[model samples]
Target: MTPTSLELSTLGHRIRHQRVSHGLTLDELGERVGVAGSQLSLIENGKREPKLSLLQAIAAETGVQVTDLLSTEPPNRRAALEIELERAQHGSVFRQLGIAPVKVTKSMTDETIESLLGLHRELQRREREAIATPEEARRANTELRLKMRDVDNYLGDIEKLAEKQLKSAGHVSGALTHRTVSIMAEQLGFELIYVSDLPHSARSVTDLENGRIYLPPASIPGGHGLRSMALQAMAHRLLGHQRPTDYADFLQQRLEINYFAAACLMPETASVAFLAQAKKDRNLAVEDFRDAFGTTHESAGMRLTNLATRHLDIPLHFLRVDGSGAITRVYENDGLPLPMDVTGAVDGQIACRKWSARSAFDEQNRTTEHYQYTDTPAGTFWCSTQTGTTAEGEFSITVGVPFDDAKWFRGRETQKRATSTCPDESCCRRPSTDLAERWTGKAWPSARVHMQMFSPLPRGVFPGVDDNEVYEFLDRHM
Candidate 1:
């Protein structure tokens, strides 16, 4: 530990007293300050000396001042250390959240510190980016959620087939969920804490104190939509969560993604290809949409929402549940009537109540109810809509295109749901079993594997070698 320059006075007494006032046990304080209980006990008992760094950490955690820890000198200096410590910790947390820091190094001179203070505005700008673009830094969010759902299903099978109930984890049930969320959270260098008081019926919570993310599973009318919805919820976690502060901008991003994903999967060429092969399709049947676009039903629905808005010829809006259970949709045709604020039982918000009304996979009892549409001063948005599912429904993807399209349904109806086909080398879903099979009985060549590896290994092929080819030649000959 780096030592601090804090002086000894009545500071040790003040530190121990402040720890108690803050409701932290000696061990708790020790953990926060990077001290052991025995060491803390000695410091508190005045049997051992106190270091400035320990005092700084304590003041930071307890909101006490280093000066207060020192002599009760001036009232202004009394809590200075605590304030500085807090400032440092907050910067660290923001960095954890993918925001840039105002300034990293310590500055002893007032002028240098003022220069650092000027960097605060830059920090704010970075924070704004993080808040505005939850979609950024989210390459695998959609895929990760889908894979986790598969993992969850695999776990469910194990849980069901086991002769005896697995030991109940009680409060630690969240631990099981944490394991799934942790992989991403760790990549982001964040800590996920389970908070019971989360505002919505989210599958998990994030930033309970500063940022609240809720994941509500979507419920389709019949049992048909449950698997898709559950998977969607997990995907929603990858998007990360926060209540949209700017609804219009947020909605715009939603619209853009809906459109982009659709365009990527069903380019004008692909659309033309479908038109040439089959004519007079209508309803944009989910299965047909998936196959036509080479994407999952959920992805197809997302594309439909954006595509319809962009082409007007398609004129459709769609809602689909991904593997994680989030009910995401892309909407088109602004003039149409739909309820925007049909949130929950609570007035004026997004909702998850319909899905919660029944178990996810209950197909027989699944049924559609009247959808509520609310007209807004700006336009129309969906209030609520319900659909039914078949008892043995496979994962369903639903697409709703305008009736004006000549062959929407016929082209869409006979199609089948498609599996994900996007290729990302770092994909967590790489077919390990397939790779193992492909390599069985074959001695994989190292040179071929090296060609596929990420370029610029940790060091050049050989350190201090200006030319890699030269080094390779020497290695081969020597």
Candidate 2:
């Protein structure tokens, strides 16, 4: 574009940005700059260009640098782009991305400028890739979790097939015994081996070439949980799921297989009836469900969500967060807003420290469940959480219901109450002044933030994470 044309747009953009950031109306800004509001509008809209002296006066009145309002350099492509990037970096909207401002200067080396340009190009490329940005990826996962949760964690087709298989195996009870699980494996002609010496990381690897499924001791040291390990392996064969093409598909298929395995262990019809009765005695506790069906508390909590949404007609929310307050799994149908990313998912996002889910880890009392009531801008919710130490260090499982819906829960009358404006100002992200003042020097938490931790890349990278292991496993299976 010509210098005159460029100057008009540049001056308008800078003036409008400075005015909006200062929260001044067109009339107020025009009055300060000694111009009529209508005339200022024409200039801001680029229909009229201001003289250099007038631009300098306007910049002075608006508390902006004169260089920002006028093209101090020629209107070349490189200069124009550098100016635009600088303008965006200074604007509130772009700064809100939480990125440190990288100031570009005419004195910078050509190599340094090229690097910055390369970074911008890479960011554009990321948009074409699936699930752009860490925030959006998190939101997408959260959305999927809730969508699967709403239907009571049931997949009709898969559940039907599972039910048929179990019924044929003469297994339709509270919990499918290990013996029954083993019997089904035998029926399928897959060799079952109980070895005392199995790799801790290897959870029943299926070898199609050898046709064998190996299991470790029922209870291994160092918190290697055995719950559903065999069933999860068996699910691979029963579900007949091939390798998924993309990460999202991989995630969905993995959860579906897990749900299918749970269906086999606690069959829908029986588990729902048990949960229904448990709710009747005003003892809708997840531990009761766990005891009645021989499932782990995490499994029990998920099962409760499934059966409750399907049979009890109660809308609920569930969350599983690790010790670092990272949300691993989350689902809600109660209309209470949870933290979400650009894609509208809450997974992999940090949970507020004051919320029941995150605070439950602080109690360190796994013997009894902790309950709290919190109010958000959207609505108030009553939540219950339990923390336990397992193979994966400490983790918390929490469930919540809306205030109106809390009446249906057992501990709705708990005197403990807290308010949360999560993912908003004045929440866990930015605590009260007193808290920071009190804990700032006393507490030394190493965030240890790593970029790789945010990646949704699949695990099972043993010894060396090169492609060799995957190739070997595929060859054996083939």
Candidate 3:
């Protein structure tokens, strides 16, 4: 294996220690090893990777074995400090400061190096703390979303695991039943318990010691919410996830558990077969898929994005926009022009007013899905949006594909069409010239600021979760 920088530094320190003990100068060692003195100096300073042959020659000249030259341990405390300082200098945290790195010299005292290392540690801690901010969270979400897009949002390992769990629970076909979910939990040595006193900050809490999965008594309006939450809790165990190290790691775990839950709710083998047949019949619809899987409209739509692109070769986008038109959740691989902030994050950005996701709010028939074809700077795309209400407020779940792939969907014939020029101020953000002239210097609207905008993300083992509340709840039950 190729040696890491730290390993090289350790090896170099060991070689230099041996040379010093033998009372040999660089020239004397180099002459004995058949290498230039300057080259030997570079090797001794860990500035160059030495070949196996060179290492063997050096070991022979120093009266030691090759393994001794390759030892990972630093020769002395000074060597350890130097290796650490070297690593800190090359780190991203130091590089981003745009300042010259402090060079380690033979004259520098160990105490000075220790103080520098302490400062470096403090800088690293502050940097990690900064990542818990909302802007950093958004940036991390954007990066994860883009990565999911690149992979077509499909995860085969989770899919296979879900399928295996379902089969083990004796789920052969149809919608996965509550009994089957219970059985699956039981098989995993967990008993699903309904309780009225779940922690306010937690959706569900798994008590590993008691082998109980405590859930709220009331089910969410859509059928799959409770099961999905339970499965997500179980996923933490099945996926072998540890406490997240950073905000990015926490976001990743959230995505993974959600993915695992969706996979369990909609088994890939069965769901794909059902969708494939639907596609063949040219009757693919989100509502139909939702009915078949007995999942929420949002879950069905998101699941389609996961499977459709990978299995059916149809690239698409999905969006979940709140009543005020903020893009709460979005995934696009079809070149849909989404409004993004300076950090390339689209979560808080407003969706175009003319797009179906926003227009669906004004539809008279809230019972049915609103379908439309929208022309934008990127291209024409068809979308079907379903608006629903929760405790939070009304939100719309939308699934759309490019114009060419629209023919394969049920809402392809809808004559409802609109145009959007988003990311352009004139499209929706800016007022008309007449309206601007009339309202300017007169309008002093008080903007309602969300508290989350000002607050730092919760600090603890789990972000946003009250650890005390959770521990208390577990104690009450245990």
Q: Write model 3 residue lDDT over 70-163, tens digit each, in one string.
A: 8787878999998898999889999999989998888999999999999998888667545576777788899999999989999889998888
Give the Cα lDDT of each candidate: 0.39, 0.70, 0.89
Best lDDT among the predictions, by candidate number: 3
Could you tell me the lDDT of residue 195 within candidate 1?
A: 31
Which structure is stronger by TM-score: 2 or 3? Answer: 3
Query: Ten residues in a row with the worst lDDT in model 1?
Result: 163-172
Best by TM-score: 3
Candidate 1 lDDT by residue in tens digits, 1-478: 5223232223445666688778988898898788898888777544566777877887789886766666643123323443343354356434676755443233455555545545654655444434422232122233333343233212222222111111221211211233333333343444443333333322333333333333323332332223222223333343453443333334433433333323323443345445444434333344454565345545545544433433334444444433333343323343332223222111111212222211222334333222222222333333222343335332223343332442434432222221222123222235478786888678656553423134331122112223434334334422
Residues 313-372 of candidate 2 have per-residue lDDT tens digits of 778888999988888887777876777666666776788877888888767467888889
Q: lDDT at 202 for candidate 1?
A: 28
TM-score of 2: 0.63
What is the descending TM-score order? 3, 2, 1
Q: Using Cα atoms with residue i matched to residue i, what is each candidate's TM-score against the true structure? A: 0.28, 0.63, 0.75
After superposition, candidate 2 runs with Cα above 4 Å error: 1-143, 149-152, 196-202, 219-227, 431-447, 450-478
